[model samples]
Target: MSGKGVLVYGEALVDIVPATEGRRAEAVLGGSGYNTALTLARCGAKVAYNASLSRDTMGKRFRVRMAEEGIDQRFVSDCDAQTPSATVESIDHDGAASYRFRLSGTAFDVAPPEPADLSDFAHLHVTSFGATLGVSGQAALALMRRAREVGLSVSYDLNIRLPVLPPPDQARSAIEERVPFCDLVKLSYDDAVAVDTGSGQDYERWFAGGLPLVLSTSGDHGADLYLASGGMISAFVPASEVVDTIGAGDSFMGAFLASLWQNGGLGPLLRDLPEEISASAMDFACRVAAETCGERGCKPPRLKPKPPYD
Candidate 1:
């Protein structure tokens, strides 16, 4: 049977933000996978999150929030250890935020592999954190292997958090290792530059490992979609007024996937989407991301159906 939903596998943790005053900061439950899963669910996609969570209060709260957001939690597992946590300072002058993570030895650090039945999902999204964490890395790889075995489409968001990986070389290696396995790979302009250098042709070479599709987003400058089929398709959707840029990329990813699924064009769109169709899809995603930035935290407002295209 063909799968009807997307499976999102990775970490779910608390984001602790320091208050402006000397008061204690607030902790919001979030992670790259969590954010993407929530966005997908909000956009009306049937999504299931598979991740390890601690028995701590933060973890429990995360589970409750997932249910409230209509995301399936059957695949989530709870452990005795603490959930992963990251502390974010205030926004920088450029509206970018910096984070310091405390994830070592945490429950999410040792994610267990999902059951073979997980292949029932139509698509799987694995993030950089899932593939770079300790035991979680092995588990994620196992899950990816199984997904591919079942002929499920795989996508990876190169959500590179420099602080987590420490050295630049290590981060690049970790990201490059997962590219060949993904049918769809997404990266930021900053991340693309960090992984390779040169002109557009050279950038295409970096993605030449048969990834099929490469999406690179440049804040304010808009996004570019590279198809292995032929020439590049570009979208210059200007960024809306900024609030906080956190989770904007995840929102874009979720919207893109949802659009592909709804239109029954996942494979063709990834292989050879027409310029106009590709631009419209990317533009809708960009709008979703911009709306996400308008909010204080990672969770964006619910998505509504757009008017039919000409």
Candidate 2:
């Protein structure tokens, strides 16, 4: 509980994806937090996953996956209800994917947090989807507030899914409500454009008061890092072969957090980072993301030890 590591709080669900060359389907243990936690654990980070699951087969499988990946499962809560599941449609030639969630009264919706049990984590990463779950939003916000009160650094991934919310405006409002609570924010190029100005240049002004460090990912074109001190860094690393783009963004986030953990200068780096150093971090994270895209799922390739400074 007193570890110098990150705790990922969100849902742990199963992804029912179509198999190659046929109509057969495969159920994979996947979720935003689950993918990020697994990626971080694979990259040799001490990670803990805080999610709610059901006392069902899928939940057991999810727990087993976490154990195999060497992630700490002490925070996984089990309830009597069933776990959420997503049915992912077949992938297209561009490696894009679509999904239909079969979520209703899942365990995450009813799970409550125990503040005393989570005060020891050094950092907390919350997904946008996790914050919008029924009643889970209140629980997650309460936990975030408690973590912030105790001086834990917070990161938020604006992994927006339009279908989950009532409307596009409502979704944007909900995500905007949580921005100020996060020290680090991650968003894709499309997400940034949609949430703010249609141009990526306006992202800094959009969340100027809330996020100190913002990461914007442009598929295939690489990623950009913006610091609070008027510094901008960008990196471009093209993919070798994109098997699927389902969890590429999550992989980038996992690597970004790992870099900050190893460097131990996240606070200063966020506020004022040299362009070259920030670019290097983005380059390393880009490699992590590209490697993940080479695989079929969210599993990221092992990362080599990077130099301390660029």
Candidate 3:
């Protein structure tokens, strides 16, 4: 009983932006996995989200948002705990936003039941706090292994949050253990440094470790894609006005996967990826992320309609 589309596995939570001047604090839909699913669905990729949501107001809002965005929710289950939240820190001049997460005892701290089958998905994408801590972390690790056993493609986004994660040494050890299960790994340069301080600013080790692609996004300086075939593609976002850089990386990962999947390259990405495909996908991903940065929060932009022809 094979199925189509991607399975997104991780936490689903809200981000509370602090009040500024006349505006009051606002709660926005967020979480790496949820944002990725939104971006994927908006980019025209079929997506199924697998997060256990609480029966609270925030969780109800999440359900509405996902439904409005056209995401599949059959895999989403219910939990008795309260919804998790992250308080957004001050935004820097460059628009980079940090966070202080309230995750302990939240719905995400509890692992959802396993999916009935792995054949219901073609690709699996995991990320963020849920992928690194608590019962959810164990579930994520097990799901990744199951995906591999079913021959499904997998991508891991190391969107590490130092404040909420374990010590660097333990965090690094945990993340490295999951790398071998990934066909593609996406992380920020800061996350890379946090993972392995001695990586010497080079991600070749990840590429050489059997991953077909290792993508690292550096704010403003743009993103770098390292290929297992010893080739590198660097993409720089064109200068654009910024709002807040919340969810920028999640949008990038989602768009990158969407581009590959839409262009018929996702399934064979690890087996035989053409240089042209990687280059095009990277460019598209950067453009989408840039658009997201212009928005207020994690609200990713949809692909613009093509101009009518004569």
Winner by lDDT: 3
List TM-score per model, in order: 0.89, 0.90, 0.93
Per-residue accuracy of model 2 over 1-310 as CA lDDT, tens digit each:
1247788877677877778865456787788888888888887777888878888999898888889888987777788898888777768786767878876777767664454665546788887587655687667777778777777778888776666756667766777667677787788866765555224454565456656678778888778777776667788778889888888888888887776666553433444445554565677788898888887767788784364563
Q: Write the per-residue lDDT of candidate 3 for residues 126-219, one digit (tens) a residue.
A: 9987886878988999999999888888998989899989998988878888888889888897887776632533356666667787888997
**lDDT score of residue 27 within candidate 2:** 81
What's the lDDT of the predicted structure labeled candidate 1?
A: 0.73
Query: lDDT tens digits, residues 1-310, model 1?
Result: 1247888887777877667545556787778889889888888778898888888888899888899989988888888889888788668755566788888888867665476595457788887676665677668877777777676778888777776764777666666666666787788877666555223774466567666777888876777777777567666555566756777788888877766665544532454445655666677788788788776568766875352274
Q: How many clashing pairs per prediction, in order?
A: 0, 0, 0
Q: List clashing residue pairs in candidate 2.
A: none
The segments of candidate 2 whose C-alpha lies over 4 angstroms from its true place after superposition are 1-3, 22-24, 115-119, 193-207, 267-277
lDDT of each: 0.73, 0.73, 0.82
Worst lDDT run of 10 residues, candidate 1, spans 264-273
TM-score of 2: 0.90
After superposition, which runs of candidate 1 have C-alpha atoms over 4 Å from their true positions? 1-3, 21-24, 195-203, 236-240, 267-269, 272-277, 305-310
Model 3 residue 112 distance off true place after TM-score fit, in angstroms: 1.8
